[model samples]
Target: MASIFTKIVKGEIPCYKIAEDDNYLAFLDVNPNAKGHTLCIPKQEINKIFDMEEDHYLGLMQFSRKIAKALEKTINCKRVGVAVVGLEVPHVHVHLIPLHDMDDMRFQRKVSLAQEEFEAIAKEISKNL
Candidate 1:
């Protein structure tokens, strides 16, 4: 079965895309932790981060770092925070969150955005990239 991220990559589903290269994809999280919360994933569906080959793992990090820097440039936040908990989905994903304080990184709190807001945020982040 294709993971949800794979579905997004294959265009089986829609995403508010922020960035992409041949091996990676970045998109805004629909259920976000902050206004610019995003998820970066490998185009290849790997179940665990550590399971990825060294170069592939580094590639994802490199891709994610680019997105995070763009997020910092585009969003009004102290800094961008990163999280990697692949519990819910079978595929690997890196969470890039715009953090105002300690609570912003916590998964307990979430923010909802309208479709327009998601599209705007994604576009702004992509512009900064």
Candidate 2:
């Protein structure tokens, strides 16, 4: 079965896209931690980050770095935090969160944002790219 992220990558589902390249895709999280929170994933569906081949792992990070740089420029935050908690979905993904404080990245906390707000943030981040 195709993972939800793969559906987004394949355009079976819509996404608030931030950026993309040949091997990776970056888009806003539908349920975001912060205003500019984004999800970065490989185009290829790998169950675990460590399971990816050496070249794919290296390329994914490099691709994510570009998105993170643009996200930092567009969002107001102390820093951008990266997290990988792959249990929620079967596919490998990295969460790029705009961190104003340590608590901004907490998984235990509930976070919510409207779709329109996510779209606006996605556009803002896209503009910086």
Question: At residue 76, what lDDT does model 2 achieve?
Answer: 90
How large is the C-alpha RMSD of every model relative to the true structure? 0.6, 1.1
User: What is the C-alpha local distance difference test score of candidate 1?
Assistant: 0.95
TM-score of each: 0.98, 0.95
lDDT tens string, model 2, 2-99? 99999999999999998998899999888777778889999999999999999999999988889999999999999999999999999999999989
- Candidate 1 — number of clashing residue pairs? 0
Q: What does the lDDT read for residue 128 in candidate 2?
A: 89
Tell me the deviation in Å of residue 2 in model 1. 1.0
Instruction: Kindly list the per-residue Cα lDDT of model 1 for residues 75-113, writing each as its tens digit.
Output: 999999999999989999999999999999988899988
* Maximum-TM-score candidate: 1
lDDT of each: 0.95, 0.90
**Model 2 poorest 10 in a row by lDDT:** 107-116
TM-score of 2: 0.95
